[model samples]
Target: MTSQYKSPRPLLGAALYASILDSLKAWLKSDGLAWLFAFKAALAAILAVGISMRLELPQPKTAMVTVFIVMRPQTGLVLARGFYRLCGTMVGVTVAMTLIAQFGQYSDVFIALTAIWIAICTAGAARNRNSRSYGFVLAGYTAALVGVPALQDPNAAFMIASTRVAELTLGIVCAGVVSALVFPLHASDEIETTLRAQSSSFFSYIAKTLPSRKAVEDVVAMHEHLITSLVNFESLRVVAVLETHGMRSRSQRMKRLTSELMAASTRFHILLHFRNQLRLSGDHQTLDTVNRCVGAIGRLLARSPDVLDTYASATGTAQRLDRLRLRVQRHLAYVAKQDGFTPVSSLNLATASDLINRFGTELSAYVHTYASLQDERHSRENWLEALTPKTDPFVALAAGARAAAATLTLGFFWIATAWPSGSTALAQGAAICALASTATNPFRLAIQIAGGTLIGGVVGTILVFGVYPHLDGFPLLALAIAVATMPGAFIMTRPKVAGFGIGYCVFMPALAGPDNPQSYLPEAFMNDAVALVIAMVVAAAAQALVMPATSLWFRHRITARLKAEIATAYGAPLRGLRAEFENGVRDLMAQQLMLPRHEGLPIRIPMAWLNSVLEIGTAIIDFREAAADITSRAGLSHLGPAQAAIRAVLPLFKKNTGELRSVAIDALRDSMLAARLAADDATLLPSERSRYRDLLTALNRIKHALRDPQNALGQTGQPSVAAPSSR
Candidate 1:
């Protein structure tokens, strides 16, 4: 010991080494991923350029630019994007060639037709979601690039289109190959990690919030997070399926899992809503009983034997939930037989039991589906329906019109001015307009891209004029290009500055025009740079002034769509209806969250509308299911009043007049009375009575939700507690 203590330097050195190792590990998990992405992008760009140069392609820079555009952190994303980019390019080139052959003699006709094509593509892009949308964007911009340059020389149109397609193909292949082979990050792995994390976090959130009196703010935040995670998971699943055959085979199962998750979350929200209503009504007895049942559920989730971070763990959790489901059923049955329970409390208990049971069923299904992913022998033949996304046709049309207007205006200006780089400017403007069509804040994105293009132009000017002149050979050129493009590639990994990075990385290469024999013309470089900047500004102006998404009318349209979900719930077919309704409403909610607040719109309006939609839509689904059960067994004659009540409320959503509200309220009251009478009938079977009671609970929930002053359909805009009262 004395000899070891003789020198503390060794100990200090060991401690320092351990600290450095920890720091390195932390960095590798966070910023290191970004650094790795940047490195891969740079390598792909260099490879694209080197091959293009060797093959003597017309424009090596096109291939290089394509590399930056398609490069992503995950192999699946890169491959998916490359595939879509290829498709878009082929379609675009074909259209460009046809347009040139037909309208080349008339510049005005060609420009107008090209603008129309861009408009259609832009609309398609805006209407679609995720990677498919990128295909539409490329289709629009590719046509512009191919046709705009060939307007002056009709004979060269075929040559230009073919060469452009070839360069793009080369870039796509190179990017895909490099991304898949070198330090590859698989989307499957990402999906697994995300599923584990989201499942665990969501379980914890439900456990903590279910039995407690969490604030409204906390619930709202959780709602937002859940919606975001739902959207991201779907996007990741799309790309992951494209990456590997195994993932492709499991696509239906994955969709089923997500759908189950959505259903389970909706059940949780409904249960929470009922709980809050009871609490606000000062029905402590009912509230306590509901809380006790919910608390039991919370305990089961909190003490789950598995962490739900792996397939094995999820399997274990599914088994646990199944057992809990049975135990809860028995417990609820025992509670139902107990004395001293009021009618309202009995109804509340029955409703809570149904919701908790449904939640357990969905959660178990979700876990089983997730666990099945590990079992290749599991049956994959059954195709499960996925969430259907809804897009507003009017919004899409407005976006397309804006893009078309911008293209036509820029094209006419270019022809009138006859500037040397006017074609380049027109192409850039069309590309920007198409690309920004789907953006939440197109004007802001355009401005950011414009700023980045300005910076890219300066960097390109310096590199071409100052650095490239002194360089020789492909290796030196590659090195210089890598050095110049790495920062932008790194920036693209960040969400806040991704648009800027995209602008810089793409425009830099276009501005430099690094061909087989480098064009070092300073005037041309300056003109292209100025033209791109002006194009971006024009795109921004169009986005800001032409049917801006942030306008009051646009927000109202979104609000109207949300309100219509109740009608959808009433009319849509019951098969796979819940998933579709939930997905559509949540999608609209996501869109509403993205729009900036207007002077005429309060910040709470969207959330209020969202709560109403979830509450009323879900209740309608439950009521319909119960009605179907009753009709199939006995008859709908017993529940005629309830059906009438639902129909009455449907019209109130369109026009919230006082008269309509009063009629809806009266109908709901009569329906509840009829259900209560049916439940009390001695002639009814036990199972039949339970069904009628469940129907009554659903109607009561809808009534309370409507009367709650926090929602859009409430009688007053003021916030107040909703006291329980018998009409």
Candidate 2:
């Protein structure tokens, strides 16, 4: 009664305050990191520019530009990038000085050498990924920045080089320190969280998709997420290794964990493929058996502890999963023989059973790796081996060729015209080629960057002439810098338009060329702006003219490469081959995802082809693993005829001829019959007989899979489905 009579004003105010605080916290939880990153970036730029002004360095904006370029969310990323930037800057300076010394008087020769160096660096950038690629990019552009500016005054080359290095170093230091000390994020933290989330999401995906007839879009989306997670994890591991000594020590475990995840995912895909194949063959019994194994695995994962939870729970879950895996394997073996006759269906069941068994085995290994990451015991053992990254030589060569052609064209144009702004064209062309090499959609990226550059140039020009005349001292300069950069920093937060910020950052400082006594002439601004725009235009045209990438030809090239990888998979060695194969196909999948949508091009067809390749390749790897011990114990001669037959058939699958594929299928079936006859040999040991039987079963399943004309191995021609297109 007394409480009811009390005034509600204080209570209402407190409740309102609590609600506001909660809402604000939620918003911060969602968007806080982005805002914090932007704030730190802007602040670093302001401080760098202000310090450069105080020190009276030439082009204080150079330091500001570095701040924008070096800004990353994680402290480790910032430090890693800064280290590479420092290294790249020194190398570029040396290159520029050497080039200037060799061809000081011949501008054309100097420009060509500079262009070639840029092309080489761009090629390196294309071959690399993540922050590693950033180093190559910086190396390319820094050479242009150092060399082009000093072309008019050769004597000032050292001074220009030294000043640029100093400015960039200052900016790097500022960005690294600010990013670390202010609300610092760690790559390790991100990786740990992702590892858990990915683990959970993967199991959840398997569980959810298994019981239902999921749409193709949903399946594609699910697989896309898994592939991206795998790729992202690999990149994060590299960055995490450089973050701290502890992380470096754990790098091997981390690498092992990634490998296990990939292997597990590969097995999962095998299981899914077998299930799909069974359905395609209209084998209801085998499909039912596949579903049962998948269901059992899902149930086990469903009951497991949160992978990101406390160490005790994770270890317990991992232990339980290990025990469950043995049970699952035994169950699969029992089911494999439950059905009689129907060689095709029985073979499908056997393959599915083997896939499930391997999946559980790999899943257990993955769980162990996960548990190892949470281990407190740090060992001195060096296990930091990494898988060799897969690269396409043709892709790298094409990129280099395009860059070289672009740079040479621009160099020739500059020489032919004898324009005063030739240096601008050379510098921008090299920089653009270097930067654009990494872009998935270069055509679209070029347009966005160009548009953003023009906008940024205009804005920067207005700010320099219209506002700076009335201002003085470091404070006013800092304010102006903030005003110019904050909007871009904010724009960088948006994923769709983040590239706009890059263009803005690059052009703003170039157009303004912020110096001790700022140039305020409209004519100077307009001339620089016009030169910058023209340079971008030349670069874009060069890119278009030299190996244009958006045509059907490029799509076909990607498709052909993907098909070739299947043949490569068939012949790969077992040791370290699985990881490499998975990574390669995933890389191709990523490239496939990047293809721009066109009217005639349906991504689904390539996607379906990709899925088929992955299935066939994965099955081949499984066959190798399964056959290795058996072939050795049972003697190669016992399996020789079958192996030779399968080998002969494999080449036929690589071609687009349906008749050849049919012949290959027939050959495989005959080989399977031979294998089954050998499996019944009375001289064979029981264990050998079992292995032979399993081998024969897998071969039969592969033969049955090949019977479907549409599932031909490495075949390019596929019936296209005209679904709503997606990228």
State the lDDT at 24 in candidate 1. Answer: 99
Mind giving the per-residue lDDT tens digits that candidate 2 earns over 196-247?
Answer: 7888887777666665443223555666777777777877878777777777
Candidate RMSDs in Å, in order, are 3.8, 4.0
Candidate 1 residue lDDT tens string, 58-92: 89999988998899998998988898888898889
The CA lDDT of each predicted structure is 0.81, 0.72
| TM-score for candidate 1, residues paired by index | 0.94
Which regions of candidate 1 are displaced past 4 Å?
A: 4-6, 213-217, 379-383, 597-603, 632-634, 657-659, 680-690, 718-727
How many backbone clashes does every candidate have? 0, 0
RMSD of 1: 3.8
Looking at model 2, the pairs that clash are none
